[model samples]
Target: MHETKMKPTINITRLQSTFDVSSSIGTTEKGGLTRLALTKEDVKIRDVFVEWLEEAGLAVKIDDLGNIYGRREGKKKEAGAVMIGSHLDTLPKGGRFDGILGVLSSLEVIRTLNDLNIETDRPIEIVNFTNEEGERFTPPMQGSGVITGNYDKEIIYKLKDKDGISFEQSLIDSGYLGDIKNRSSNVDYFIETHIEQGPFLEENQKDIGIVQGVKGTKRHRVQIKGKSSHSAFPNSHRKEALLAASEIVLTIDEVAKQFEDLSTSIGVFDVTPSVESITTEFVEFTFDARHIDNAIKDQAIRLIKEKINEVSIKRKVEIDFEETWDANGTYFSKEIMKSIEEAVESNGYSHQYITAPALHDAKFMTDITKTAMIFCPSKDGLSHCEEEYTSIEDIEKVTNVLLRTVISLANQN
Candidate 1:
């Protein structure tokens, strides 16, 4: 059984004040934050966060990937520190709570500790990683991907945004360039507080989610090619690409249904022909499939391939598939998982264990440390848009949980 000890109550007022400042940092249309990764808005927000970190009386370090780590040294300088934070970068017209809540809540922890003159046995670090949204860059979790050694630094630098601004150029322009360093053992335990980004918590009226694991994501680009035929020739001999594309779309649903535990989505689709009567010569679509278990994810991928091949052969259309992304699911350590549950129960916040359908940096951090996440409810299940909303009261509750978890880890070690 874990020992029962309580620290001073974290200053909810100050925490809410910080979150409000962050809520307006990169406000976009419809009260959304539009700070994409490595853009001007992203730079402005990162700079503002640096100022907050400095004011909290912590030493800050920026890595080559522009991930910022702020340190509050305790009496034991060499002890492995406890770290907490999330990304500050926002998606295009993203809601304010998606990434900012994790970051600002971490700041609130530092602010509380500094104000109370409470010194733990271990140092505490607040991290604000660059480009967690990966909207400007490609593939979300760019910074954390590099930190966890899942992605190479060179590949990340070469990533380009819509305007063709390279990730390297963005880092240099933002003055975030720093020496590349390995991210390991700087912390013994890591925690991040973020909005649920889904409707599960709010629909259930739960105040928090003790994340069990991040879902594994499989992304594919599928292409279907058939003979362009005359409008009048709509027979089976025509091998119309659009016809085959429709079949493939339906197959996605069929295959997804076969895997009851997984979530599948086909978000992007394009057909070349513009004329209504003309059969499209080429059709392409992207598929994003996710599951918390690798076995189920693998089974889903296999079934999709089998169905695509079968349909292509029957329709006599040329078909091709390429895997654009494969991110594995990540599980949090038992100790950290227990701590999150304890925090939830101690604070009297209704909580449940849920898998995150979206990818997060926490997935990468799991490779290096004992990592977990705390989730607050997203109002109306809105995220990645300007409509994203999470109440300040919920943010405060998660912050209190984050504070208790971090302290519990620090004191135990």
Candidate 2:
């Protein structure tokens, strides 16, 4: 046990050792993790997690989506559990602490409780949500969505990876697929602690972030069509799709700049007949927009659409714009937020209210139960890459706050 500010705290040494062990499972050459969902590496990590949970005296189970759960019984088992969770799967190349820290920290919380022989009035459950990165799956946050009835289980089961392996098959291969009845629906409150994944906390010199909500995201695909021409074609006679697509990309940046908090990008762009000498006739790109307010996000999307049409007319090209996904902003539980704030205050750590730029499983959990999140600062605001880093001192601060918050929520009358 480590003592900080005259308060008993979790064993940071154990937490770091566990993190190092977990990081080695899908280790990339650059020290990043590539533990894709339900892959062999992911399964190995899952096995280790289950083993740790059992060792900690938690009753462990898995849901149909391979979302793993470990429950520590409290005095009253009938009451809804206070749940702490996050994902473990990473991108093809992702930072070490992006998704893994939340799980390890929650596990340490349980270990600390056991060390002190403390019992609350309600049970506590720690979860490892599957496919939160959605690298193999098309959409992310599959496990929590299925358990919450946000996504259709059958459809998710049939979803395939680039290697053509189905999700159900992967679950079977992993041996982690349990019954749907094992899903968590009786959670009284949910809290997830993750890395900030942005520069906000570090730039502000804050130790942690008390997330108020997650930003709304809208995904769309657009195609612009024009006449392909020879390399020798006259510039005035050419109506090229590539130029139109580039203009629309600029419009996305322009529209995003109009709103102080909005972020927009074109992550994917493709041009037909991509030859150096020939002008492309067709172009396609993905349009992604995000904002704290759903209506404002939609407003920006509409403005971009208008700009796309303008580009079409000016370039004399045809445009087809279609929205593929939409997720509205979600606010967390105020009571739980207060608990987290108080815990931060008790720990004497600096923090501020933040609207998460990226979404998490906690965002989906908000629909079924009261959900809140804590964010530790990411060095240089980098994540989903090998460059991401966070210090042990910051992790300790956030974990202690989480421990305090969980104890407070679990014992609440």
Candidate 1, clashing residue pairs?
A: none
TM-score for all predictions?
Answer: 0.95, 0.97
Task: Please give the TM-score that candidate 2 achieves against the real structure.
Answer: 0.97
lDDT of each: 0.84, 0.91
What is the per-residue lDDT of model 2 for residues 295-316, given as tens digits with 9 covering 90 to 100?
A: 8998998898888888888889
| Regions of model 2 farther than 4 Å from truth | 1-6
Residue 20 lDDT in candidate 1: 77
lDDT of 1: 0.84
Error of 1 at 165 (Å): 2.5
What is residue 72's positional error in candidate 1, in angstroms?
0.8
Instruction: List the lowest-lDDT window of 10 residues for candidate 2.
Output: 1-10
